[model samples]
Target: MMDIEKLQLHPAYRVVSDDLRQRIVRGEIQPGEPLPTESDLASRFGVHRSTIREGLRQLEQDGLVRRQGKKLLVAVPRNSDLASAAERALRMHQVTFGDVWQVASALEPLCAELAAQRITEAELAALALNIEQTAAHVAHGRSVVASTIEFQSLVAEATRNQALQLARAPVSLLMRAGYAAIAPALPQSGERLLEAHRHVFEALRQHDVEAAVGWTRKHLLDYRRGCEFAGLDLDLPIPLAMPADGPPK
Candidate 1:
């Protein structure tokens, strides 16, 4: 391996980091797999060990790796992991959850309103598929939370703006995770939840933007109320890292 002094000017660190991240995302480096030793990495990148160390540290902070004694291993991807990174990005740029929620809430009603006017037969079929899956989950004594989120994601997709889709990406991801944690505590379930989506779907089918907007707003507000009723701490500095399933305590 090259000595530390020679490593300072090399551009390989970023190359190696990006490649490793791509591999991780592609599952080439599967979760729980051990990474090559620092010495091995140093040789592969033709850099000093210190550069590898720095790159590894960055990956760890991104929730991509963990050190155990002398070994470094990949970590399982978690929604909270993404949420934590998003939180840091938001704070570093002086963003707040309330600010984001306000914007998200505003955008969503409009998305639903537009979707009401623009939904195609294919989109309606997709919504029906999601609703059927959701009902199946409920019948199986499982939370339909993920299917609910998928339904919203489909609605968002119907909006057809790359900027809106990109902006809503992280919010939808993290919110779904948070919702799964508290879904079991909701006062209504089964027919009630099913009926809610069915009504929204029907409104979209009829191209009723006004009804869509009103009902969409009510749906989101109901979710917030459910979070409160379940005693979830939405204001936590870190996104609430909830278990994959069950009501939060």
Candidate 2:
């Protein structure tokens, strides 16, 4: 009576994909388990195999499924992988520097506190090496922006909290991008960055939670000052700077 036949319908492939996605999310299909063959899915859903292919493609894009040779499998995506994707989306949405910095200020200190308690010897050694490299880079008057980013990532990894690592990654990326944008004009900021990193590294290595948290908070504050010195406008949306070869890591 309401022109039912005139209503537009969603493609059959999307419907198939949504159904499969729900199954996967509900654990009907476990990670690392092979999906039914496209032919089987086509038969079961009363659709063409091509439609099943299209549906699987959507799941792949969403990081729910992966191909292992000739078979598709339910895949558990890594937190880092998911974070990288989120960072890209944030860039596309024109997230601002202030928006990122506010999140970092809250999460970073907690990450440091946890890392001080949980970091392994290997991670501590890595942090030490990073500090040495950053010192050398600053001494030679080279840009330490990349090293700075890596150092923070190492600290986050040391925390061993998957949720924290994932949540803070985009903020870390934004902080590095902001520094890269302004570091050229603020040469003295390199020394300050190096000092802050060293303090945080020392606290982490010693497993001093209070010191680690305090140093990390201080470092983040210093970053804000550096941005101000460089005259970066926090209110403006952060600029997206993708690598020449591929997407931002």
Candidate 3:
């Protein structure tokens, strides 16, 4: 017979959260639905109320539950929030600019291609506004890096595929870490970014899949070239620092 393995007991709070999280994921608990009272949960789980509270806190941080006044409601993790979590994980792992770009190049052109078919007028207007702001930033000699990154976010949102939107968000966040560092050495980058964004926006407006994808690919290539031009080592890890609250809005 095989020897019995040593028991490694997990925390009670983790056990509680794990059980509750499964229930929420399995749809037994639903979005906008209030969780049971803490006292009730403690009784059900045969744990102290403090234990239950700790467990619930984990769920809150996981974005599986939210507070509505005194009630805890089940919630879906927004793509943006999920992306922030992913960005943090990436930072901890010392993800490189090349790592980000490799994934982004795969996702971004596809995002624009999908948006050409699925984009809404509001999203188109958003992209237009981004380009407008980018142009202004360029004219005023202000950094356009953030606006360029935001334009990518807007394009990803326009795709309306939650999976794609969430997947691309963190990549965009990582790109910002590099963009801010490279901008000073590449003064013409802002105008180049504005031109690329405008071209893609027009393609999206005309529902031109090829042009949209083409311009997006060119734009991605431009980024790699910019990094090279700036003498940046693509292998260098992006800065681990993020905004205090999370990735920039």
**Top candidate when judged by lDDT against the true structure:** 3
Tens-digit per-residue lDDT, 14-43, candidate 1: 777777888998999888899999999999
TM-score, predicted candidate 1 vs. hidden true structure: 0.62
Tens digits of per-residue lDDT, candidate 3, 1-249, equal 999999999999999999999999999988999999999999999999999999999999989999989999999987778888999899889888899989999999999999999999999899888888989999999988678878999888888898888888988978886676557778888888888888999999999999999999999898888887877788987767856223222
Worst 10 residues of 2 by lDDT: 240-249
Global CA lDDT computed for model 3: 0.87
Which stretches in model 2 have alpha-carbon errors above 4 Å? 1-11, 139-141, 240-249
Which pairs clash in the backbone of model 1? none
lDDT per residue (tens digit) for residues 24-123 in model 2 = 9999999999999999999999999999999999999888999999999999877667777888889789998788888999999999999999999999
* Candidate 2 whole-model C-alpha lDDT, 0 to 1: 0.85
Model 3 pairs in collision: none
Model 1 lDDT vs. the true structure?
Answer: 0.73
